[model samples]
Target: MVYPREELYPREVFDPRDVVDPREELDPRGMVDPPKVVDPCNAVDPRGAFDPRSVVDQPKVVDWYNAVDPREGVGSRDVVDPREVFDPRDVVDPREELDPHGKMKVVIGRLQVVFSRAMLFTLGLVFAHSLVDAAVLSILITHLTAEWNEYSLWKAAIVVNVQEGTLAVAHIVFILLSDVWTGPYKMLLCSAAISALGLSLFQVENVVSFYGPLVLVTLSQAGIVVTLRPFFDDQVMSAAGQSTAETQHWTSIVWWKCITLLAAASAAFGLSRINPFGTRSLVSAIIMGSALFWFLLGTKFYSFDEATGSPLRDAAHVMYIAAVTKRNVEYPRTPNQLFQNSSGHVKIPPHVSWLRCLDKAAVVMPQDQEKPGHICTVEQVLGAKSLLKMLPIWMTFLTFSTVSATGSTFFLEEAASIDEDFNFLTFIFWQRLSSFVVTFACGWALEELGRKMKVEQRMILVRMGMGMGCCVACCVAAWINARHWRLVDSMTVSRLVPQYVLLGVMEGLSIEGLDNFFITQVPELTVRYGPAFEECVLGIGKFLTAICIYILTLLWRWFGEDVYSSRLDKYYLMLVVLSSLNLIIYCLVACWYGDWRFPIPAEDDDIETANHNPVDEAVQEILLQHEKDSLPLLEQKAGQDTQTLRSRSFTRPSSPMVAHRRFYSMRS
Candidate 1:
């Protein structure tokens, strides 16, 4: 099928970079007129059997032979089209030329890399926090201080639970950072520094003075995570970080697993007499150093699309809000002419729906082709009041955050129980080995797990699994401290090992899907309320757990010390009951979540919403009107640099429809 030179590579007005020699791309028609768009990710065959149009577009490469629709057999209900999920514009079949399996090899390797790098950084924080709690929990549970282990499991749960709010608290603070205009890197650095300091003190202290430092560390961590959504791909949403585009929930699961596996290995196979507390402190130091290094260096690649905070972008949104309320003074200052021309950034009028504006040459702005004032306004309700329209979202957010925080705190003690003999590297080694095997199993069996389940139902099952693990943790502790529990005759090392691993598995399930659920329900409140909401739920759980423990203690008191020592399993069984209640509540909440309804496009709701950008209009207005009053603070913040430095802006994509349409596509 040789063609004239004109047909193979034509000279045209289209940018050469966009051009792909049809011979190289999937030019199925040697006889067809002008060449077509290319697919980069999928490398399908060039023969007439495939349409190639629906495939992704990308840099042209020559070669052909491969099945493109391999996913058809695997995809059932709710299965997402990876093409649309990754990007709509880049729909070329990257697997067209290469063998089908070859691309998968590359894709898997890429996934491992992407997954690992992100997982390591996030899990490091979880490990850091859990290490501290493990030391505290271990010491208290073992009654090592000559002081009575008077606290009930609920009280222990509360102390640890309060800090779980850190994840959400970080988010709330990050929204404020949007107003203050701080970046994710800075937020993360601060979080790490504070966490390290807190852990260091824990290494040299008793429980009486632990709360102050712990609170500081929790605040910093929550602010960083909440504001800076940890997912790397969606890091570049806005300069002020008002509108979130990416979610960092997956990191929670990955970290939870890492922490649990590490802790379990330490507990099951650690030195017979090593101090879990000291080892945790040492590990915390190492993680802090790594955090500082990444926050400084790796941050260049990060952007604030909810994964990080971007202040300038928030300023632009403020301008949008001001115009809506007819306040001209609050508009984003028009870039000074000198910088404007140099930066190639002209102010767009406020009424413009960014989704409907696409600036081709520029990296940002991809809604419509219109410029500035030409963009049109969307008439749908899109403010705080609108959020109330869907009352169930907040309810679910609260319910899930509460349970997730409880479950994660339950894991904290489990993670801190690493083998005394394992050094940091060895601990990490065992963690990697266990994680690799377990993660593979989960991936391989996810389809089967989801077969008869909705996302909500599956998640409840996950929570119950975690609850069972907590029961396992209590039983394991009782077995290890059997003499005190009056079970010295039956206590054995082997009995504890399985319990440790069981808890790890449970942590994997409970921690992994939590953030994904929260982000799904309340994306709009992310900037101002994301962390606040998360922290509030976590705090409530922790506080309640503390109260429950007190109640448990009173109940145990009535029965006498002999009763507690002889019937420790009773306490273990009680945890099972409590977790069961939470798991049931989660499933019920799932029933009420009608994701199918939303004025915002489906794509906008994604964990990586390519274009879901909604500013907190109420919050933005308050900040703008008060900016004059806060001028001193702004001045200290270096004069509010909402200006762009280069010919670039990290904008949020706005196709919520596309995101939602296929959200339930990848169903079992």
Candidate 2:
């Protein structure tokens, strides 16, 4: 029978029942064949002829399955068995399909989640705090010597050194308080308020007022710096979920910090041009107050953990117990024999062969088992070891830190002595701007390198070493510049650019590398204290610098009352020698240090397995059930085909399309 045109070739709106099967009208072998079924939805022409060109020249389909609904357009001729179409083995993972770039998309999505309202406000606070810090550092010595005209250059330098020392001490104290008594949120609020008050006090001129406000501002700034990163990290991890990796989280922190520093540098440049140092201080206070208000607005979104016991105290306790415990006590034969709580309250690191002496603390004596407080856990012993191991590496960076402290004190003084009319770039502005630029460049380069290399921990140590090397180079350049200035009658500030640039590069690499090392290498219990310990070391470095200066001034007239006649070239050479020695020591320490970039498998595996989503498990179970249900139907169809084959002569089709048509014909 001749079918109507509408029945032969279905239009876009035609019902499935309206389309006639070609096999019914013509022999299956003689069916009209298109060149290829490129566009399955539009294989036929309006006149019921197979359209090869239309099929071949079709637009690319993004969502092929949804382009034409199977339930609506599929006729008897197009229908295929569900078993053949829905193979579980062929199913693509939704994550792979959705994320074309794999981990890149995931990292980007995590960053998007982490940069919430609370994080943005936190960054705002960082920017404001950094701006205030840069302003204070830039103007403190200048204000003392030039603006106030009361203190000599050496005295002003001493004041700056004292401020650095105070900052270092404050970092440790504030971080301890945050970890043991006050939470980070309260500490941040209090510190910001105190900093604002101190900035306001810059309006006063007396020595008592100057020293008092200097101490207050240094203490408050230290608290803010030591507390902010850890707090920000907590907020990020909470927002991004627990699955986020340490590298991505820390990388994001560095990127945000770079941006904050860049903006702060721009502000410092503006503050440098301001007539009076007090006006700059007042502007900083206003910015800080506004940031404080902004942070308060996002209080609801911040993640706040309760104050816990101090890790430092726990480490000390572990050492005391280990030392007080009988020296004759035998070390545990195996790690399992060590004192671990039955309830699994603490996570113990895998036993290492080194530091076997400390394992005595974890040994359970026959009588001490009943008294719980007498013996320390394996976790605590390992924590003490971790802290002790970091000390050598920490000490190596002291000279680097001392070199950094000079940027605000002697570097500023040197730049001020140069003819400003010859060079517009001031010390504070150039140093900050160069640092921001170098930080951005180095971060980008390192990120790209990290993708190709697996040596993350090694690279951190190398980067730090490179930074120290740069500090040595910076000091050498400073010495040369100083010598040139003394030799020339008219030397411009432009000559100091190389030293400032090198110093910036050094700060970018060493500071960031050191921060990462502290954050990642420290035991989990003491992770919050890492930044504070770094600051403490930095403070000690400042003290060492001060001592060096005092001794040099007393023994030889290296620093005079002002910048003009001082033997700064000699001082820079001394710093160069010290930094070179420290760089060598750092290399030795790096050689002794073990790689900690990859996590301990024993501790992480359970955490990774336990972190699986329940919804994903449920979906997998449902798919398994579907496959089980589908098996019987497939078997039944195979049985029916076998019976049909036995009853009649059977011939296999030459091609897949012919077989598909024949199967449909037999079913019909």
Best by lDDT: 2
True lDDT of residue 395, candidate 2: 86
lDDT of 2 at 63: 31
lDDT of 1 at 604: 22
Which digits, one per residue and each the tens of the lDDT, describe model 2 over residues 32-109?
445433445645554556653554334344435334545768544455546668998788776433332222223454
Q: Residue 582 of candidate 1: its Cα lDDT?
A: 49
Candidate achieving the largest TM-score = 2
The segments of candidate 2 whose C-alpha lies over 4 angstroms from its true place after superposition are 1-114, 241-243, 246-251, 325-337, 341-356, 420-426, 443-453, 594-668
CA shift at 234, candidate 1, in angstroms? 5.5
Compared with the true structure, the alpha-carbon lDDT of candidate 2 equals 0.64
- Candidate 1 at 230: error in angstroms? 2.0
Weakest ten-residue segment in model 2 by summed lDDT: 659-668
lDDT of model 2 at residue 260?
Answer: 59
Provide the TM-score for each candidate, comma-separated.
Answer: 0.47, 0.70
